[model samples]
Target chain A: MTNADTLGALLLENERTRPTKPAIREKDLGIWRTYDWAEYTQNVRDFAMGLAKRGFGAGDKLCVAGNNRPRLYWAELAAISLGGTAVPVYQDAIATELQYVLNNADVKVIVAEDQEQVDKVLSLRDGLTGLEYLVYDDSRGMAELEDDAAVLSFEEVQADGVEYGRANPTAFADAVAKVKSTDIALMAYTSGTTGNPKGVMLSHGNMVRTCRTFLENEDVRESDDLFSYLPLAWVGEAIYSTTVSLMSGCSCNCPEGPETFRRDGRELGATGFVAAPRSLEMVLSEIQVKANDASGIKRWVFNTFRDVAVDIENRKAEGLPISLGAKLKRAIGEILVYGPIRDQYAFRRARWVYVGGAPLGPDSFRFFRAMGINLKQVYGSTEVSGLVTLQSDEMASPDHVGKPCPGIEVRIDDNGEVLIKSEGVFQGSLKMAGSALATLGSWKAPDS
Target chain B: MPAASTAGEVTLSVSGVSKYFGGVRAVDNVSVDIPKGSIFSIIGPNGAGKTSLVNMISGFYTPNTGSIIFQGKDITALRPNERAERGIARTFQNIALFAGMNVLENLMLGRHIHMKSNLLKACLYWGPNQREEVRHRARCEEIIDFLKLNDLRKQSTGALAYGFQKRVELGRALALEPDLLLLDEPMAGMNSEEKEDMARYILDVNEELGTTIILIEHDMGVVMDISTRIAVLDQGTKIAEGTPAEVQADPAVIAAYLGTSH
Candidate 1:
């Protein structure tokens, strides 16, 4: 086993090697603020101190609810550094849903994104007596808010962090020590695609180990760029956008909102992208609709290239090399055909795409690859930390989950439920207090 | 849709054009010629088939019949991107700016039709493609300054107000540097002041740039003031076509307006 002790130590390692590299690019109001490796480590430190100053030290649990934004992530890393666990409530979680997570985790402090999010917390605050202070990041609508009941600005907290960090040097490290891989990092509520949302406690090790295992099989570069619009509270996004990004020192681009997705996705030209079937379906619909408006000559060219793409796909599907004639033709056609089409879709830099959240149709899967866009299906959940089985571009597997990730050992039980045992395997069961540390338990057969 | 097959001086022309959505015929048989520099206006009530007729011309929708002629070529079979390449640009019924992009980046999309380089050149960031990109960026900036969007140049379109967003959409259409500029209700939902501002901008776009202008507008005051020629459609057919005063007095136009609640 490659003994990497802790998540904080991993961050430190990346900091030393890639201090100047951008770790996060928060596209705010059209302005890109780069949080490089060095700055990122320090910001997480300050965030830990700030939380401590706000009365959340090691062993204290907190709740954060927000869309995919930089401050939301910073708050998470900060919470982690301070040895405090956090319950990530969905951004779209209504008052009752928020009530369940907050009440269950017995949250002491809460950091919300905006007034709308804070209102959700406030709606349930009467029931959540454990909640002490409400930290709101976006103050856009809060300026006119008449009720301050227990509200505090995120800026004010960060300012306190500056003062707190100055006074207590060992406070951050001390907080981090109590946070082992075995320590539960998040109480992610299940998406309930099948049933009601269940709080799945994932540990630091569960997250990092799964990420590292995937890394061993797939190639991820430090220079890779990503557009992280998926909900931070979703386990899928946390694994790809947060854990994987932090591990590789990759830059994560946060779009302004869902409305600006296509424009933002085009602008970022992200090297690694992941989405559910719906998101991919929406984009593909636009591409086809727009292509329907092409001129005769342009349409002809597009058809020829699409044919070439189909050939490429078929060859790979049959495990055959592209014929010499086809190769020569494609090289020539690239000038008149494929290159412009790829640029149009802004998939020029895309290394590979993962679409899970639901089953992806074979036609949908092959169409992207045929056109030289590497997209694959991944199967896993919040409990498994993103992907346990993912297909690479050249392999093009159908009807199979393909191979398991390096360290994640998977076995199908009699009930047909896949059980994964690995280095970061969390023993945190749903039956226990959701925020409790992982208990290192074996997989049990599901009850009828 | 008629083929854009006129032998000479045919910038954009549509003949025998009609559009049907299920049982409702949005546009009836219509024929029109927009000269190289003429300012054409398509006006009618909400269901007057003005926008639908324009959509046929801009290659957004293929007509169930007739042909659309542009610059002595047949583009009846052309798609929107092809129309874009053949020097046709258009705005949307609702603003369609890339909200994640700044005003500058939105304008850069206009030049996308003009970019000659491929993805390889872009990914490697070298060769003649790189030179063209830099050159186009300078041109885009010039247009931004001209539009007085310099202050909001760096701001994301999402952060902008509706009026400013429409202006950015206009700027994006302008970036295509097309011979034909199609403005789809560019002043829709704007207040009087915003309308005036947009009217002035549209006039500058047509006059200063010498670009052919085709627009859909509900505001008759704005239409009468700017349109060189006007075509009115009712129930998918051109009911009236003439100078502002002539079309304004046409019985068919008045009856169509009276028949529908405008």
Candidate 2:
């Protein structure tokens, strides 16, 4: 919308507009470190130049495997800035499972978060003949491999890139200018329960258009804080944390580690939240446990107000008018129970919270809504760049996912299967020619 | 007892050390020379005085009859605090971390010997004191990252699982950055997976940091697999001292500790 067609261009735009604004924050060693937009762009540029110095360019694949860390996000943008596609492997994936995805994606360069991921990748080195460089962010427990020819630290690569940039001043910008909007940006692998995971290739145009359209339909703000705790391998994370934050100029917060998510989430008080159904269930379970362990009077107050909130939600959903007396009671309940509960769970500033990836249990869905969280269900998959339909704010019931996103068309076919047609629809799956062609033919033209 | 036949310089030398608890001879004339940068394991059956010998070396119990030299200095008369200052760190068989403190705080407490600021200076919190605090915190963070304790760094030690508590103890000991480390059963109550993780961390400390480790564990498989040299004790007396292969084949060690089936 702003003449920035690709994600790299959007990043450059953010740096030009708000150079000093905090673009990302990561909690490390019990302290939150903020990197402004100017710094973020500098990191992306240096890493891009570094990759370019090593013969990485268009059609190459760079794999990022690790938890939600700021360096990993920069690595993703660095790959894209060099006109190469970024493939994120799940951090919890075992060695053999990792081997399949690495081989299938034809990854040439890898940016591992720490020694754990580096070890996993090194274990499969025999089969990964295509991989040329192994870069790691944290160097702890890696003293033994420092002299290896194939391995390099993140700082070392950046330093090399700095030297290269000095020699060729405009090399990074030139490469970024070469990245077309229609170029493949991300390749995410499915879970592969039935077979090997398929790589869904989404173009820069696909991701940028989808995020822009969703932002137009929603109230996401430039001042919002988005928490990036989900696996980067998921399409939802790619859209929400990486693309959406880059486009909207919001700050993305990454927790210190997996165990610190709850504490860090509370500290950041993020304005945007996205989680799968299982994570929503975990939140509900935590609240229930805390409520049960509360003092007698506090528990009584919680249970009573919870019922009131649920009653109000149900009446509102069923199109029943609330009496003035009931409205007064609901307002009092919000002050007494719902407000504190929301604050405790770090939903106080949450303007938009979504639960997707699967249908949430009705009880858990209603429970969150009752606590004053606008918990909405989204329905989509990796094939659609993570957005086909989204529940509106006023839609409270979990019976169906809300209407289709702006400019997207969804229709049921003869076999009772859903078909989506939108600009966000991915180009095709990599290495599966038959299914890729079949998928392209299945998307019928919208009945304009 | 035969001398440890390793090639490196001896980091800790215990010559005919004996600790007596009233009438019970907890440790009777035990001698072991632990080489630098080696994983030295001490194995024995119940009541074999392995812990007693470790307690004497760590200065919790002074040897009644023998002198202990660490890094070429006799430390037999030093107190526990003095020994800790001399680069000796130990983790208990039972977790002894401060129950109310978080993991980071417990590990930070391990750096008490290294802090130079007095109570008054620390209370003022200016200049040198603040820098000292920051330095110690950074060291604690390194240990946290090394032991993979990032997730539990802020959780209370008492609330952690048993295996995690043991790991936290190990982490606290590692925070000392000692030249000689004594682990008196770091993997006592862990399942196989926890045992494997603890064993890996121990080897990492030995190989990566080059700390001299004297491990007292009951798991024979772990002891045999990771130890550079083995010392077997029976009823407060040294029975065999050699490499794992030599100790495993020794008839006296097999009859005393490893059963006939082993």
Candidate 3:
């Protein structure tokens, strides 16, 4: 693997090495549309040129708000190529919350996914003085605003990029070459449960190194597929779908919309899966609801095999060896119950499934493991560029998030707070200087 | 209150139309004008001959008396399929989608009248027939995108939720690409959120495609909000026809439908 420091350089390297390999897939018109590495980089180049033509440049922020769309991901990489930082806003944020994040970031260009998001942005336009352009990917209900000065469709901007690229052929390559590892690549805003949200600025090196170290410790490869259905505002989504895919050359699959997440996930048969505890609970409950409605004979078969699998899992967890008879029963249980359950939940091919963002219940955790899923818990926050600790295969349990990742040091203070020191730690908050450093330094004295 | 003036050329004109079923007058001398590129809604209580009047206009039930004119052409003797070919497409009060077929197949069925490949050519599935299939599929995909039915495109219509089935029915009608669209109680049996989404899609279809619409709805709030002109029908008779404000303030309309207590 190439040691590409910046995300833009990584994308360029992939395009050179594996131009025909699928880089991204999105479900559109009930079909999986593929974009190879060459097309992926070309889209980023065209969009970066378009942004430059519209006066977006170095250090400027481009706010993307919507579902996990291919265009939105490409927009993020395009901004990074132009030496700008991408700020992803939660798609479901209310107008006032959106207004706060947009104005706080001083975003110059906003790329919205569809009419719903476009309306949210336009409703707050009078208060956003720094906003220069409003770009929308879907044009379903935007026919009336075609001539509006401030609004432009995604195609129109891309067309402008084509024209600009024709005139200045080498401009996109030169811009990609200028981005440095120390430059800020992303500015993800916290959910702001306490007060106003703060923008966490992460440099290119922070993201690249963290993804590289994490991928090296795991078994992720170029052939792996990841189902990207999470909110783009979440740092975990940015890390796995964008940074990790760029590092490993894996394809990220996007569902058609929120309503089709499970269906699309099953269709993709993703090899790597990431979900929060709440999502796992939802899946578990769905299974229960379906099983409750099954015929008596089917239910009996399911229950019997499930109990057998769970019994085997408990013995293994207790450091007990399984006898040959018990092992044979477990194998039968795998074929009868666990195999079908895994296929139904789209986890049949998942090799590295991570559950994070909250503590998953032990019952639900054991239930998935009994169904032949390698479900593990990860621990981190946005401030540390997504992950600092991941549970190893043998240490898989519900209670503890396992050891610190490579290149990370974790220590517990006398006050019972965990302190982490790593190269992946964010540089600083966007507007608040020295606060993050101060918070980390305050806990460092006890350790010393 | 002043009458809501017609915006442009009259698209559909029903003059003195009447329908009868076993000596019972279903539609009695109903006459209304739908202007081009306007959303005109017809509202009334149950059994007020609202559906009868719409069926007569769509050529489902031929008027026993009076003539129907569309864009200055007399179409009183035309069949339902003939009217559909004349740029008039409609959805039923109850969803009329092909339950056995998926969303894409049902929408493609709507384009049957436009298909030119004969049986022999279609069976061969080569040259012109293949190109035609591709072209129609592209149009269907566009309608799917417009209505946000990409997720359900491959799903059976019978398996869809009530709201989504209604949307698919609408998408099928849209695949016909009609000039004047008819929607019969499109928001019936919907929750508030689904009703709101249907209203948005209706407005989008009208504004984006520049298609004239004739909507028959029971929700006064929705009818009042979206209609460019309002027509109130009661007992197979036209009670009042004007702007939403004019209809709401009319003595006959309030006493018959909106109630006079307010």
Candidate 4:
């Protein structure tokens, strides 16, 4: 919980303290392949060294576009580890959308996922004047890729890094030692539902503080397992799955693919999970759809126990005492309904889950609570590294997105807009590049 | 001619393949180089001999003139089962699953070419057969899990809906663990949502499983979305072959299939 915590230092500490503990696991072809803290750090080192060999140095931006692969997360850390900034774009972004992000950031190197993304980048290469190299993760159909020097597979780069490390061992460690707390770590582009997207530049200190605050305030611990199926471009994913995992020494599991997410979750028995409101609604509606076609007897059994559980929840929330009979009925409901429902959705081990990005509907919120799932609402935008206020367990409500998290001060301005100040707040957006010097002048003044 | 078996190299190549039904030439000379781990689609109007080309690759029909090279091996004269043994799996334009069999059983049957337990061990249901069955069941479960068909694992194929049956057929083909998968109109008879789902699954099988796919479909939207490259077949003659964007822009393809409106 140091004030000057950087992601590189956090990872180094984790590697030194818990080298054998699982840091990341990816389900590939129906098997969970784990990389311990040592291996995790090694991969990051290799990636950073690889970039260094390719002329990627301080202040360079590496654009990442891919599914939530372990390599993508590590690439982000690798860039930050080398005093560079990582910019991740949504995997499904169209050509025009990607063009805006890449061009705005003036990214020199782009690490894409597969042939689909490689094609998109190559097609837009003529428009992107600054782009120099294209690093692809999956090499399928890449034989036809036209450019030789521009296109390099992830494996090829890693191999180059390994060779470079063999030739110069101390260089990698020296680079890591140079990374400071205030250095920009990653830039997250907002979804831009309203208008054009903006790149929010977050520092290493911001991520470390947000993760450390969340870790200390919540029930999360070293033993907690997180299923990181969310888009890597999202700030929440970086905070929870990457930074938090590094800070807490917990294992983060990447699902095999979108189709096998539920099965992967069940296999991991993840204790902590996070999602946006829309994702939660989809989960609840899927459950409702399944329950709608249930037979009369089954529905009656489900409903009777669900009522008991909901009653117990309402009484608990109201500060009223629950009777012994009601408690027994709730237990019965747990066995008959809640247990199976939770097991089916792979929420059996879910001790803490969060829904954010928008206010969740009361019906879905209450439904998860009634089923004894500790679902909470988190309130924040990407500009704050995705954590400002979080609903505490005892004060859980669908409407209110809870009190301010640790180290955050909130106020309402005369214009009726909520303003928050926190260590986790981003340095600024890339759009403010030209005005940075002017802003710094006023920022350093005692009275303005 | 045998080519080197290299990653991302041509996994299957059809060299001037021609097929004839007596006097009628069902398929004229056609050549396509299907790369490894790519979704290569064949599209045209009705009666375009797309199925005949698929049959020739799957060994359901022998080519009158040309050879099929797969992984550097010439397999033009191979039988269907022999081709299946060599890691070639395909689904039909029409549903070809056994209606009487349950979903699990149908999927398990796809592994028949891979099973090697002796008859005595299979009948005894002990030792090698038990271990083999367990191994195969686990593999089938992976396919089922991949396809999200947990609810219909035990239901008869006939009792399931059309879309479910199509998914089951895909699951069966996936059970074969093939390196090359041929899907013929996998989204046919499905609604928009189901079509989207099927398209995603197809992409998953191609990208995740690293399977080389040759697809034939009438739905241009799904094809354009899923396929890395496409070859247009108009009236049994190959006209254009390139990336989705290139194929979409090809004048011959636009004139023959997409029409002037597109």
Q: Go through the candidates in order and give each one's DockQ.
A: 0.02, 0.39, 0.43, 0.11
Better of 1 and 2 by lDDT: 2
Tell me the spans in candidate 3 whose CA falls farther than 4 Å from its real position: A438-448, B1-6, B20-31, B44-49, B98-105, B117-138, B150-162, B233-240, B249-262
CA displacement after TM-score superposition, residue A74 of candidate 3 (Å)? 1.2
Q: Write the per-residue lDDT of candidate 2 for residues A235-326, one digit (tens) a residue.
A: 99999888988998999999989988888899899997988999888878887899899999989988888888888778887899888977
Worst 10 residues of 4 chain A by lDDT: A439-448
lDDT at residue B129 of model 2 (Cα atoms): 94
lDDT of 2 at A354: 90
**Best-performing candidate as measured by DockQ:** 3
Worst 10 residues of 1 chain B by lDDT: B1-10
lDDT of each: 0.77, 0.89, 0.88, 0.85
The TM-score that candidate 4 achieves is: 0.75
Better of 1 and 4 by lDDT: 4
lDDT of 3 by residue, A179-250 (tens): 999899999998545678989889999899888878977889898998998899999999988998999999
- TM-score attained by model 2: 0.92
Kindly state the number of residue pairs that clash in model 4.
0
Score residue B14 of candidate 3 by CA lDDT. Answer: 97
Docking class of 2: acceptable
Give me the runs in candidate 2 sitting further than 4 Å from their true place.
A191-194, A293-296, A395-397, A413-415, A434-448, B1-6, B20-29, B258-262
Report the C-alpha lDDT of model 1 over B169-261, residue by residue, as the tens digit: 989988988889999999999999999999988877776677888989999999999887889987677888887899988988988887645
The candidates, ranked best first by TM-score, are 2, 3, 4, 1
